[model samples]
Target: MSERLTSVPGLLYGGDYNPEQWPEEVWEQDVKLMREAGVTMVTVGVFSWAGLQPGPDTWDFGWLDRLMDLLHAHGIAVDLATATASPPAWLVRAHPEILPVTADGVRLEFGSRQHYCPSSKAYGQAAVRLTRKLAERYGRHPALALWHIHNEYGDHVTECFCPRSAAHFRDWLREKYGTVDALNHAWGTAFWSQRYGTYDEIEPPRTAPGPVNPTQLLDWRRFCSDALLALHRAERDVLTATSPDIPATTNFMSMMRELDYWRWAEHEDLVSDDAYPDPADPRAHVNASMNYDLMRSLKRGRPWLLMEQAPSAVSWRPVNVPKKPGLQRLWSLQAVARGADGIMYFQWRASRAGAEKYHSALLPHRGTASRGWRETVRFGAELARIAEVAGSRVTAPVAVLLDWDSWWALEGADHPSARMRWPDLMRPWYAALHARGITADFVPPHADLTGYRAVLAPNLHLVRSADARRLTSYVRAGGHLVVGPFSGVVDEHDHLHDGGAPGPLREVLGLSVDEFWPVPDADAVPLASGASATLWSEWIETAGAETVDTYAAGPLAGQPAVTRHAYGSGIARYLSCHLPDHIGDVLDAALAEAGVTACVPVPEGVEATVRTGADASYLFLLNHTDRPVAVDADGTDLLTGAPVRGAVRLPPLGAAVLRRPHSPDSLDSPDPANSPDPLGDNRS
Candidate 1:
């Protein structure tokens, strides 16, 4: 199965198909239409639990059998569903403990998918039984290309406070800290009058107004994440025991707060995600770019599937905003530019009733006669044309260090500042790279850094000794390293390392931080480029670092907000403030000094991305705006099959791919003087 998938030309094209919702006669028509549109796969049984097992004790496989047989008779492969997204109504009613408990201690009713209690014994047992049953029945089937686990786990509100959850939390604590004393020290319960004499006394943190304990909330988040992972593992173990060759994956919501996907990535055969960008929002590129990097990095540069993107607009979101013309196809190509192996939509055909009835689909309510269908066919044709050339292409030379343990450790600390949010600190640097047409892979802190030329670690609050050594060696070998301010404050156990700010990394970074300035009420700090920026806090370096930039005009004026240190033939740059556009120029200069630059030329309000393989190179030029712009490049336009010798005009929100001849010096050929400078634009 893996070999077959790897040998496929370009990205796989297909999506979710629910034949149980329609009559048997309609199935043939649907298959005919899908083949006409170049669909090669169909996901089955996503929301079929109600149909598969109508009662608590009885199970039926007749409908699923017919559906699978029909799909296999055609040439379309199948991503077999686990049917565990939602339990039958009888099972939920019979075992009420399966329902989830909210953070406020409220038990929810069983009405929606992903509402099952993670810690419930009955729920876990039932899920395991059903999963094994399904695996045993169809694991050896030839058409099963992948194992699709329960759909989109942990999308709703999280945290369970029931008796089962409480007991599991106690057990998890025992395994983590071994004793109450160690737990107390890590959580810093001494200041809150919340010292625990016994494990049973611990409780999940409740939302309140002031001075809440960060450690307690952090542990609760970790516990919730682990609980869901256990559910995933339970299902995966059963599937693998039966069908070891089929890849197993659960579709993830990118950067979701409830489940830590980094931890979950270790258990799956491959990573898959659902991406739905808000069309009304102007920063859709920023959001989509972040998720693409995240998905790619989850498997350490292995290709992942875009499991669920709306064909047009989603019905569940309030207002049901439609994707502007050309945006859907552009976004699909954007996914390929990152590292998606397959592009699939949520629903192949729009539903006639239910919560998602209004969701747009390839075959909309008007069938194959409307603008939606026309666009779908056009995109399908485009994909077929480029399929042979785009397959197996890789992106980027730069890497970003993302530590899951670091994320957990920082959020678990007993810090004094309320403004230190993790995502806000990481987003700026990520956006900086994306705006420059550079693809940055999100690597785990402990990952091998032998091939990368530049490394960016943003808000890496936790530092492992082994990872520090690797970074040191990479720098010593003449690789660039960029470490942000809130780094190296804690260890894996969420406990302070204690020597100085940045702890173990201080030696490698060559800086000794004295204190951090928690800017509580300061307005946006003006930059030299006439832009203002806001930051949560800025680190005040007292000694042992060269100041690169300072606050332009404020109480902190003339104080260093950015610093750089030379170490072993390489350098380390530390950004101390929330960077505005002006600071991006400084970052670009640093990147240039390190002998790395953006892959393509970027225009204002346009996204420039590059994907390359052994025999072909693709340059994606995307205009992410409402107005048209002129673009000029030196290559053959892939879409038009014509030589692009000079300036080319682009329409509003349009995209074009240039198929340049592949060579060792292709990246270096576009001279800085002739190319549009990415750092000159600040719109992103």
Candidate 2:
């Protein structure tokens, strides 16, 4: 068997296909249209648990068998789902105890999907049985390309405060900490007299009067993620045992805080994600790029798949906004530019009736003449033209640190300011880099930073001693480092460091935080560098560093707001305030210090990325603005097969993929970049 999961020859293109929803005559038309749209793969049976198994023992595979056979005959492959995403009403009605209980002690009903608790034994066993049956029936089918595990693991319900889940949490705690004394030490239970004498005393951190124990809340978050993962593993084991060669995957909600993807990615044969960037948000593409980078980085630069995206507008948002004329193709190609091996969507055909009836699809309600259908056909043709870029790689010189543990702890209750969101602080830094045409990868705090020119930790509220040591060594070995506010403040156990804030990183950062003065919402304070800081500011006393900037107003006036220190062979810069407006300036200095530059400079609002294969490198340029722009390049425009010498012109909301002879850039030699071209003629 091949190492790759998708057995298709070129870049895979398709979406979720539900033959059961439509009549038998419509199935024929769907297959014909799939061929016309150049779709090679489709996800089947995602939410078909009810239809597949009407009762506890009854089974129905006649319709599914025919659909599978029809799809195979038409040359379309199947990423078959285990069909356990949502349990059937029969199962839930029979075992009402399996329903999830919210923290308020109300058992949720089964009107919506994903109503079962993660720790419910009845749910897990039923999911495993169905997965095993599917694997046995279609394991050797020619159309079976991949096995999709439970769809979007933690999308609707992440945590369940029911008695079953509470028991599972206690079991998990027992395994992690052998004794109650150790658990008390880890949770710092001495503060509120919340010490635990036995594992049975601990619960899932249900609703409390004032504030829950921070450490218990953190552990609850951890347990919730693991519980869902355990459920996935149960079904995965069945699939793998039945069809060992076929790869298995589950679609991840991009950057979801409910599950720790880094830990979950370890079990996946192929990393895949479902991305839905709002059409209303102008800067949505920037955040999407970060999410795409995280997906690729989950498997250490291995090529991943774009499991699902909106063809146009999504129904879930308050104000549903449709994609403009060329916006769909532009954003889809952006995923390829970031590192997606394939592009797929949430659905194939628009539903006639459902909660998602308004969600856009490849074959819309207006049929072939619709703008969405026409655009889909055109985009599929374009993907086929540049199929050679499928297995290519993207490389980056910088890494942004992301840790789910820190995210859970930082966003928990009783912090310096509730206004300080993890992603809010991260977006400005990443957006600055995207604007600079510089690519970056998201890595864990303990990830190896050997090849990266510079590393940035936006906020590591929870850092382990080992992670701090690795970072210290990286800086000592001539790697530029930048750490944001409130970092190194606590250990993994959520206990404050001995000296103060910036615990283990104090020596490397060359400063100590005396106090955290968080400004009120919509308030700003003056900085000595002429840039105003908002949301967060810290009083600092430098140990062995040079003060870069100081607060000019407020109680912390004249105090250092930003500082730089000379470590072993490199420099460590610290930003002690929320400086979204001036992050680009700080990053520019770090880039200069680390000798990192953009892959190829382009005009503002134009995105530039490169993917390198063994023989050649492909340069991708995307014009995100409403006007045409020219970017310097030298190679063949893969979309048109036209040779380019100097520059390539991209129209409004346009893109270009140029295939050139490979030239190894030293900084990103080990990392990889994402996907391709838009124009037919070379006219710069």
Candidate 3:
């Protein structure tokens, strides 16, 4: 098996296929129609636990075996599912304790998918049994390209506060801390007389009197995430042992609040994600862009697959809006622009029954004659035109740090303000970078920062002492660092740093935050730089740091609102309030200091991203505005084969791929009538 989906000629384009839902004869027709749309692969058996194993003692693989063989005959590869996403009724009845419990102490009955407790021994045994059975059966199946693990780990049952979970939590704590004393000290258990005499005294943080211990709550989240990850590891190891050549993966949700993806990524051979940006959201592309970038960065800039995206309107939202004409194609290419190797959807054909019956699929209920089917064919054809993009990567000079530990600890129930949303607070920085046409890789806090010219630290509330040292070293060694508000407040253990805010980084930042005020009811305050700030504000005293911006007309009027401190060969800047409207100016100044600038100047709403192949570089231009905008880009438009020299007009919501010629300064003549061979060299 190939490491990536690029084993074939072009970018892999296909989605989930459930043959059990239709007649056996319809499977052939499904394969024929799919091949017509240029699909290369399909993920089967995502939610087929009940269908695959109708009973604990009884097994049925006839339907799936025939389907796989049928797809292989059609030259379509497979991303086979383990059929463990949803347990069958017989298994649940045998071991009722496998059902999960809510934090409110309700034992959820098994009526939906993902109802089993992740930490249940009985459930684990069943998962292992199912995985081994699938691996032995499909170990060398020619159609098998990838192994899809249990679907969406935390989709339904996020956390299980049952007795089984409690036991697992205790075991995990003992392993992580090694000793009870170490655990107590790290948790600062003395705060609320919450110190446990022994490990058995500790229980998963459930309903508590008043506010729960912040340490206990944070640990519970970690434990819950670990439980899910352990399940994936067990199943993944089984498949790898059976067929070491085949890569294993599960569809990860980008913004899932549970099951921290950063921790789960190491277990995956390659990265894959299910992206469902609400069509109703006007800023959906911005959200999708970040997700695509994050997914690519998970494996250090390796190409990933867009496992699930809607071809039309989704049925879940309040007012499920259909995708605007050309929007799906634009979004699909947008993912490719950001380093997605394959484009796939949730279902191959629309569901006629079940929970997601109304979810959009490549083949809608109207079948081959529908607009959804037409768009699928058109997009598939476009992918066929740019096969060189596969195995390539998108690299940038800036990194926006994404720390899951910080997110887990920062906005606990009892903080300066529980309303301080870490995710929302981090969005402005991302949006600012996007608006400037500067692509940034999402990295962990301790990742190598030497490659990036500038690093943005936003709401990094949980930084260990070692992490703080590494960050200071990055800045002192001549890299621009932008520290967002409420950063560096606590250590890795969720305990506040002894002295003040921003802890070990206070000196490098040349400032100290003595007080934090939760002013949710306060209005936006004016910055001396002529911009306004909102939501969060902090009081700080500078220690030899220059005040680049200050509060203009608030209670702390004329005080230092934003400060910059030069340390060694670099500069460290701090923002006391949430990023303001003048953020572009602030970032541009840092970017200029770091010897970097926007990739190229383009009108607002036109997103730009570049993917560099081994022998050529491909630039993707997307026009997101309402009207066609002229771009000062010079390259052969791969879509039309036209050599663009001075300016080209891009239709609204339209996309174009430009493969740059060898000479950066010269625009080579183009063959407008011919499509570039996807496997050929970069030529015009």
Candidate 4:
């Protein structure tokens, strides 16, 4: 047994393989095609609970054993799943209580996947039993490389309102708070005369006439996340105990709010993510890069795996647009540009029957003669050319702050505005950095910020005293800090801070918010800096900070819209309104002040990133436009044997991974006159 995912050379390339769906005769052809595609590994038995166990007393491992042997003979590794993602009809019929209940009090039947309750005792016991069974049988199997616990934990059933879940929620509350009095105080139950007398009276925030207590809803979300995490831990413990050398993991949906990936990453030996960036979105690459950066930062810059993606169009979305020619290869390399050790997809072959029958796969229904199959083979060969990129790390000098607790708190029912979506507000900041060719890593509020030159907190709406202290200490220790609007307004318990807005951060920022003025009905507030803001505005009365920008024409015309405070050895900047246009200026000023430079200068749509290894550094330049763009570089392109001297012209949707043996200074930005026109129309 090996600790890593595979022992073969090069980056892993493969997808989920369900051998049971096809006849035994087709399995040989599948392995031959896998070898041709340069696939080193494949995930097996993800949704095979029914086939693996025909009945409670009857067991069938003959088919799995033969498939494992067949794959091993063909020199392909296996990421064997525990086959507990979807329960069989027998289990559900035996204990119908295992089925999840919606908030509207409807017991959901079990036709689709992920239909079990997170807190069901019966379900947990059965899942653990199956995990132990698999581990015991495959502990010494030659093809086993990694153990995938279960498929996407909180995808369909994030929270359950059944009686079993209510009981589990009560138990979780007791463990977290220890007493009814403590729970009431933490939840602020005194509001709306909703104080509880005992723990037995608590429920899972079921459907109510009026709005439920905000804190209660927050706690319910926390408990639901924890309940799902407990299931993963239970199954993971069996595998680790059975085969300690083999690492265990479960696929994570990128930026999923249901389960906290930061907390979940702590339990994983290797982090793997499933990302689907819509092809219809023109700027989908920008947001997809943000998720990739988050995956890299989850385990502190460890190289993770891209578990699932569509080779072409996906079947789920309404429109279901196909990935344009060369788009899949471009985005796949983009993942490698960030930090993905392996590239995998949902299914190896297209499904002939099922809900996802129309979903794209490496081997489409047209088989080996189709363009999709040709592209798949080409992509695999491209991955083989850059095998040295494995085990390298990407270091970022700038960090963007994201906290799950804050995200759960900010999106409650009763808020200042219904338009304050976390992802929408945070994407702009990341896009600003991306457009400037500045690579950034996502960090939590309490993460170690000493390594970063600047830290951007786009929206930390819920911050406790400890989180505030960490930010203050980071700024005092010579790190630039940027605080966004509607931040520091509430504590961890969903209770408002006593001192007002920017509560614990008031002293560091040197300002206090008088009131939040959310602009109504498509109105823009003009700023003295010649830029306009929309959606949100805050009235601030600075005590010791300098006003950098102010409201130009409004009731609070002379009020400060942006302020800067000089702390111990650094500066703290605050934006009181949502700056849709001028955010780049604010971030550029901060980056200049902190002495942070971009990796390289390129055209507007081009992306630049670097991955450093023990012996060499690789610079990735991706041209994401319809025309060729020129880039200055001096290295060998790994994709091609050609040597790049002064500059290289990349064709439309082209990519180049340059291997630099020495001279790290090549990453520094060139002089203004020598640099390429960043916003010019470089139409080749």
Candidate of highest TM-score = 2
Candidate 2 ranges beyond 4 A from true positions: 1-3, 663-684
Candidates ranked by lDDT, best first?
2, 4, 3, 1
Query: What's the lDDT for candidate 3?
Result: 0.84
RMSD of 3: 5.3
Each prediction's whole-model lDDT (CA):
0.75, 0.89, 0.84, 0.88
lDDT tens digits, residues 1-684, model 1?
131242335667878898877889989899888878888777888888888778877889987787777777787778889988887788888988888887677888877676788888887888888888889988877677888999898777456787788889989999989999999888888876878998889866655656567666667778888988898899999998898878889999987766777778888777888999988888887889889878877765566888989989898777879887788888888887676778889888888978788999888889988888888878877777666444344555677777655776665534745556677777777778777777777777766665566888878887876677777877877888888767877665566668756777776677766666555556577644454546534646635568877767766677677777788877887766555445466568678977776665667777776655555667778788788887767677776777777765668877777777768767744321222111121211
What is the per-residue lDDT of model 3 for residues 209-266, given as tens digits with 9 covering 90 to 100? Answer: 6888888788888888889999999999999899998888889998666777777887
> What is the TM-score of each predicted model, taking all chains together?
0.90, 0.97, 0.95, 0.96
Per-prediction backbone clash count: 0, 13, 0, 0
> Over 4 Å off in model 1, which ranges?
1-10, 189-193, 206-213, 389-391, 408-417, 526-533, 537-539, 626-650, 658-684
lDDT of 1 at 245: 72
State the TM-score for model 1.
0.90
Better of 2 and 4 by lDDT: 2
C-alpha positional error of residue 55 in candidate 2 after TM-score superposition, expressed in Å: 1.0
For model 1, state the Cα shift of residue 570 in Å: 1.5
Best by lDDT: 2
The true-versus-predicted C-alpha distance at residue 443 of model 2, in Å, is 0.8
